[model samples]
Target: MFELLHKKINEIISLTDEEFNYCRTAFTPRKLRKRQYLLQEGDVGKYQAFVEKGLLRSYKIDDKGVEHILQFAPEGWWVADLYSFFTDEPSSFNIEALEDSEVLLINKSSWDMLLQNVPKFERYFRVLLQNNLVATQRRLMGSLSETAEEKYLKYTQTYPDCMQRVPQHMIASYLGITRETLSRIRKQLSEKK
Candidate 1:
């Protein structure tokens, strides 16, 4: 369980075995059943979860009760409401398990402590946030400039594993398109191949 966590951390910075062990002390392993809610709208998010296995999604329901998926976290990814976790404010998004999931959870307090104890962790988190920001910017640019088919192709090429794991309708939601549009796109792609 800690292997992925350790590897991910090492990719950001070299941590001595002792430092890794200290960092490990701050995390708690959690198992979430499929469809379980890790966070609900209006509740403050307390922890950031590192996905060890399975999938989770963060979404918001509009006034019409349609779920708009914001992001998906598969194995080896991290998920959380950063605004809610950092500010202790209620989150507008809900994070739910798409499949039975194993995760390592680090509470805000523990994260702060870890950063103080191991300054290198600050660099790790900084890089993580930078990468997330860059990806988000690219997604926003794509949404503004790309056609539905273009978006669909980009998504599949970038996250082919996610297409296999996530449901079609949810993927459509994330792409800001109707399920019918997604089906058409898939059919078009298949025909072209």
Candidate 2:
């Protein structure tokens, strides 16, 4: 159960077996059914979930009722409303299981405990936050400047397996383009190949 967690953490910082065992104690395992809500808008985010199996997405519905996907947490990824998780405030985003998933969850108390007990995790989390920030910045810039085909191409490169897992409409929503536009872009790209 903790194998993926160990691998992910080790990718950032190496840990002894004893240390890894201690780290795994901070998490609680949970299973979510497809389309089930993990965190809902207006609710305070209680836990940050590490995906052990399957997929989940964090998104927000605008007043116009269109969903804008913020991030997709496939296996080995993490998902949470960071603002709400840190501030103990209501989250504007909703986190849902895109498929039946198994996740390891760490609540604020457990997170604090883990960090306090294992200082190396501070560096690990910092690296993760830094990478997330960089990705967010790049995505923002891409949204403002890149053409639809460029966005789709980048998305495909960044998440090579996502196209097979996610539906076309959700992919369009994530790319900030219309479904028809995505289809056109895909067709054009395929024809060029």
Q: Against the true structure, whose TM-score is highest?
A: 1
- Compared with the true structure, what per-residue lDDT tens digits does model 2 show for residues 58-167? 99999999999999899999999999999999999999999999999999999999999899999999999999999999999999999999999899888989667999
- The lDDT of each candidate is 0.94, 0.94
Compared with the true structure, the alpha-carbon lDDT of candidate 2 equals 0.94
- In angstroms, the error of model 1 at 170 is 0.7
Clashing pairs in model 2?
none
Alpha-carbon shift of residue 132 in model 1 (angstroms): 0.7
Give lDDT tens digits, candidate 1, residues 75-192: 8899999999999999999999999999999999999999999999989989999999999999999999999999988998999998789989999999989999999988988999
